[model samples]
Target: MAERIRTLTGHLVRHTGKKSPDVQNVSGNLSPAVQSSFRYTLENPLKTLTKNQRNFYEENGYLVIKYLVPVSALQSYRKRFAEICNGECTVPGLTVMKDVALAKSSPIQGEKAVVKIQDFQYDDALFQYCCLPQIIRYVENFTGPNIMAMHTMLINKPPDLGKKTSRHPVHQDLHYFPFRPADRIVCSWTAMEKVHRQNGCLVVVPGSHQGDLKPHSYPKWEGGVNKMYHGITNFDPTLPMVHLEMDPGDTVFFHPLLIHGSGTNRTDSFRKAISCHYASTDCHFIDIAGTSQENLAEEVIDLAVKRTGLPREDIQFKDIWTLKSRCVKGEQNHLQGY
Candidate 1:
């Protein structure tokens, strides 16, 4: 445990937006380095989680479980968040609603956020919240102890403000991240309250991780910016879209490539969630500059683009972390290799 903490501290000091391995997997194209890391991650996944975790990721691309954060932690976090927002506590580098991008220079297409804090050190709640034994167990069950906090933020959907809501554009986490050994990376989406439909519950296109990555535009929120899934309409209309109505402590594990977005917060209460991404120590970076990997690797098959049982263009993996997930007429999906 001490070694993991020490290594992660080193990683944190050197951390940038992307920290994947040099040989990474982006929709089945394998750089030799990524292949080795993939093998290592596979061999020790059970060491971090039970057999159930491996099965969970294989079937669902993520694990939606709990105990990642405790109720007391949430309460303390909520108070601190409020204090910062209200200007009662002032941090030298923190940004609040006052720093929102002015309407005169509105950079995005929707209502701006009320607060955006960057480089938020989790000394108070985040450390304890993220390092919980249950949470560590789940991660250990997969990637061993080589983990670091990628990023943190606060996106408050205050009902009184009636923030204009729209889909946050669908795209894989790898598109913007582009790290090596992409397969070892994981994300945890934890909620701060009851995330209901009216309160902007996150909607996910389950199993969409098996297909191609679509084009997208990112928006600047708080003090940070990230990719948003929009402009790409290449999904199977038949597959059921799922909305995760999560509670305060529940979190959703998902592949970075899954298709997901949230609706407007029409309800009276606030709905918020913290999404943190982690990866194994050996994740690699790829050499996409000169490989046939420009298109989805031949091994990473997409049911929609292949048109095996139906139309050929039905499935496709157009972007970095894409897959052909929509199979036809009760056909079984066997993700061969990527």
Candidate 2:
């Protein structure tokens, strides 16, 4: 029945020998409510969502909701997605640009994607599904109220020829967005494809989120800020590395700085996912690298101009935005495209 359910749990072949490492002094402890939620992990294997299973999301930055969007919702989104996707006709963001010259120039596997919707700056589904009630309540269960929408994105990795697998490297996401200590920023990835070990799904190092988020070279995702990979690594021989085994409509939520990456898609099908990052309104974007908080926000404006939409209010960064340069020249994006 587990096999029939198709949610296979396995460790990474490369890291198969690696065990979960233990810490002498855990950097942080899980809240009681968060710890208790793990008890309700999905038992049916094919179930949509389980209350107890939500604990992982609280303790860790992410959780996997089996069958998150029903097949009907998924199909409906797909149809609308297709229409929006068609509009791009091979612009920078849309993968379906395959039918166009630039997209045709680069093939995931000789097949070009006709990206209808290009990047999150334009994609709408992210707001519709990424901030789902179930997802919001999941976070509210821990962080309480005053949650605010941070940023949203839709990745149209076209079938056969996509970036997620081959070109995609490992990295921590939160490092891209600076947040205060008390306020946490969370991200959720919803699979529009049958994400499995065979087709290059998300792989994460459990408990790794609690450690130093290693510095990495900025990755060149089609629509996202160039991101870097891990902060540190010390293999333990007990706990196992796991792939975010997921299916269309299944959603996985993780922390801002979780060390994670995916393998290349050597398969024939398309792998589509929607990622949304949320931060509590109470969570302030701070920069602590300065000697004092004085003029810190102003000093970083040139640096953070890339991260527009950030409120003009003063902030004290808790993480180093300079860990990796926000040198992204995302200037030519379709901002005012009609």
Candidate 3:
């Protein structure tokens, strides 16, 4: 118990986030049953999920579909990533390493300074992977037949001596989204290579999505990225979390509301993963004002105001969602807005 407390405290200090005292208690000493219940897994063939697979996802908020992507597909992804790293790709969405001198001057240094290619779907290879037949079939289990690829990211975690930016603070995916019917929203996170505890693999709390969205805020880490997104500010310490260790082609389909994050890549090599957030066209955009969604919206809008020099009042939830969204599958329903 003391060791766990120390672990949590260390994570809190290093991550630049705050957790309420009550939330911390959840992680305190407890029996094995409590911890075991928090870790779960359901596996099925790559083509689609079985009946039990859907049940496990409903009960636990996540499903791990092994070998969903063939090795050849992963090889293609690797080639694309290599091209971006080697400066061979001039694609607009590829996030390139910035000038070393300028990057080093920032408060966050070393591996914590990893770059992410946002909306990499703009690239041909990634776009195909986003709509891969196997992936789409798995997503249909949650979103029915109508699915839209709402977000995509290729996160490159640089090796870190201190495991700093290599890890993300625990948070819910829906917090960053303005859409509703969260139950219909899912994420397919595919491991591009071997991912394990030492390489900062994802960690998630089972059944965390069964409740409403929780509060989130930026961690107070000094010298951190200025525009970083908010994360769960408080959580029950007792909630069991599993460190997702996967090999290439193993993908996890998860609920948007699940409390999840990753550790730092302690190894010498960089860890890469490609993920897409999918939502049903049946979902609708909701007004964030005067709602639980207000906090995150305010943070996002504030950044926009600073970046574009626009007034906060002029910004609407719909505007933000539209700017960040791209329809990859079915048509987007415009009428489902506040």
Candidate 4:
């Protein structure tokens, strides 16, 4: 146990530049169960990931698997997206959000005006992507057998309108999640079309998931930031970053704490991607009352109250998540906190 403590201490010091008081306390109180859950572990005998792939994910916090999704699936999703946007179909509980810049100005009609749709778990066609056997196989490796699709989105990054409102600020996904043992959570993001730097493909800080979740706030960009598009306040600009340029049907599975964002779409077309955040059913909700996430929780609760016409006192951050999440694999367990 002394050797283990030393190793953890060294890692903490190296990443943080000094040993944190919280780490010191945790080291002294470390338990075997807690230590085991400190990071993601590959299943013995392995399910879908090769040893090298598992190692890469452990070291880099993300793995890009080319052609994990098929072209046919991507086409179907695109068709369904257009149908929804064109008002040919309505997806109950799905929130269609327009680009802030376009919404402020003369809004484009039909599908072009919509920038994204969130919580589409109710839409069977789009939800099918979450249940693809290949995706579930990879997701089980990170989240174990029992999985819950905690959040879902089909991001349509519209072309920049002079203002760079299309650019997403660098932030950790965990900042918006109220959950414990973040290692059990992973996000699967697949490109619907060829994505490159010009179209604002994903930009990730390699291995940034090894650090703790930082405080987040809306960036003071001259162009108005999107609602709930919070950014890491202290992200080091000098950190080496990788731009993930992917072809259609390519998917990347990344840790929730990995710091990532995309650039503004400089092309005339929209950059589209489908993503879902999955977590182990064993993971439980966490209270954000005294943490950096409190601000986000409050904002989310307020938005829920306004949208549903529910009393502010009756809405809770966890309740909102519970309503949005659905079991994609295995049996639903702890995440149902209403």
Candidate 5:
């Protein structure tokens, strides 16, 4: 059954090996809840964000920071990603190419035709962009001076043809994360090409991050695996959804709890974007039991079992999270680090 599932899904279950070189000592004696309250001092003033930008993000839960990357630099990244996808790059990373069988389903089912290249920052060219000093300062404005890039991805959203993958359901980023202090986590999404409603720009519900963590579930689809992504259950349509239409080099830093998702690409071209989740190393991962987090964790564990051909009972939630979590900057001082 596992072999058949692998044949059907063509999933790439690879692990990341990158670690933050500058190891720093952090207090490990504190409890998870107490550790979340810890804050780091910023090296500079609030120069990264103007008074108005600060007000907007505090009130709306997101900010669209324009010209974070130059178009020339983004174009180089675009070329590099394309080359990696074409097997021109020899560096090892998890690359999920477009699945033809899933794309040809009658009703257009399973995951979308989008290709997701995870942990591409291993490449020096891509690493430079992820650690751009100016951008890191902007991230420091929100997450403090001591920050770590927990997750990064190069997503190529293909055009829509009844493809469910092209259109992501409105969901909270916290659903996939096991860490605490949701306020300290931020995701920077940069457009590699001009993006608008036609090309599936991100749509986020303002002020959604201020609320509590909500339950999440997979949207009903034919032959779909949870895929470690869980969306908010029964998201209210009455809430306003803002379309984040942006040009190449434009980036948006959003809170983890913000309810956001992208629409299907109605145009013919692929919508490319590079994103990374920056988190405070001071925060710890609390044990989530009997909560929506545990529920989603189980969903992810099932997927991992199928992909690794491991028994469900043999896998623990912590093991799965430890595999996914990495420290991109500073040191990993959280529970997983020890």
Candidate 6:
């Protein structure tokens, strides 16, 4: 059955204009030959990235492209976010989350109070970011022609309210994912404004993607940690970190295993960015139980129970991801199993 699935997936990729030689079998454990063929970076010809750019990503686990998004489009997204916060618009399946510090303190209303919005695939305006031609062009280089936008977020890093709760803990993105062949997944984060250290820009450890997924849990901080904000328990503090200060429309595409986090927003305003995690439709979900991802999966299931008032047994972790994922390009093959 597994071999049959791979054959069908390979045929699908060929029909979609992607070279079959670049396709990997999506079933069972990857053999050494397959693993060697699908390196951290693609060896085949790229659609948008130059050879130097591809080499940079291979060595550093990330690549930054300046002015990859239009300022006008970002402004439009900002307006839509404000409308959603002000209760002027409703988007089904969207989650509006407030900063943990602000949630405890005096209630500040509107967009300023909300820290981020998740699962915005149902919102046409914001979801357009995932389908941007410029983005997909680069994304196809990493995830191939058949792609699925597995996750979406518009982060609003609110100014710290003296508690330093606005800072996200350093962790790997794969900690929250239950997918295999981690090389097939990539995240594109675009700044919605000028982001600097003072305003909590992204801090990344270069070449971290070559490492294995580390164990993670909530960091112990005086200010309460936000729901689902897990941190690497054994993160090597001595490892060199780079602060990614980006202007509006500057975008970075990174591997899932890259260790990264942001500083507190010391500035008085919000630091905003939009991002989507894309994976090859050829990638398949894995059982996360008894693994480092188990804790997060349990938390997500618990949250689902509270939100939907459903029986705990009915809401599996994979089901949550299956419902959230949407195909951005080509056929949705292996990833659709719920």
Which of the numbered candidates is closest to the native, going by highest lDDT? 6
**How would you encode candidate 5's per-residue C-alpha lDDT over 1-338 as one tens digit per residue?**
33433322233333234444432223212223223222321223435677677778877888887888988888787777767766676543343545332445644422334356665544656656667765777776566655667677887877765545567778999987888788778889999989899888999999888898889888875535225445778889899889999988899999998899887778877789988888877777777877788887877677667676766776666555444445555546663421
What tens digits encode model 3's per-residue C-alpha lDDT throughout 1-338? 23432332232122213211111111122122222232222222332566667668878899998989988988887778767656675553233443232366656643335456655544666656777877876776666555577777777777664527556778899888888788778999999899999998999998888978887778765535324546677656678899889999999999988999888667988788888898877788777778767876777667556555555566565564544444555446752211
lDDT by residue (165-214, candidate 1, tens digit) is: 33354456655443455555666777877787887777777666666556
Ranking by lDDT: 6, 4, 5, 3, 1, 2
Per-model C-alpha lDDT, please? 0.48, 0.46, 0.66, 0.81, 0.68, 0.83
Better of 1 and 4 by lDDT: 4
**What TM-score do all the candidates reach, one by one?**
0.60, 0.57, 0.75, 0.88, 0.79, 0.88
Candidate numbers sorted by TM-score from highest down? 6, 4, 5, 3, 1, 2
Q: How many backbone collisions does model 3 have?
A: 6
Task: Report the alpha-carbon TM-score of model 6 versus the true structure.
Answer: 0.88
TM-score of 1: 0.60
Cα lDDT tens digits for candidate 2, 79-187: 6566555452222122222322234355432223542232332233333554455555554433333344444555544333433423245566654555544225566
- Model 6 residue 242 CA deviation in Å: 0.7
Kindly indicate the candidate among 2 and 5 with the higher TM-score. Answer: 5
Residue range 159-191, candidate 4, lDDT tens digits = 999899999999999999998789999999999
Task: Give the range of the ten consecutive residues with the poorest summed lDDT in model 1.
Answer: 322-331
Q: What is residue 219's positional error in candidate 1, in angstroms?
A: 9.8
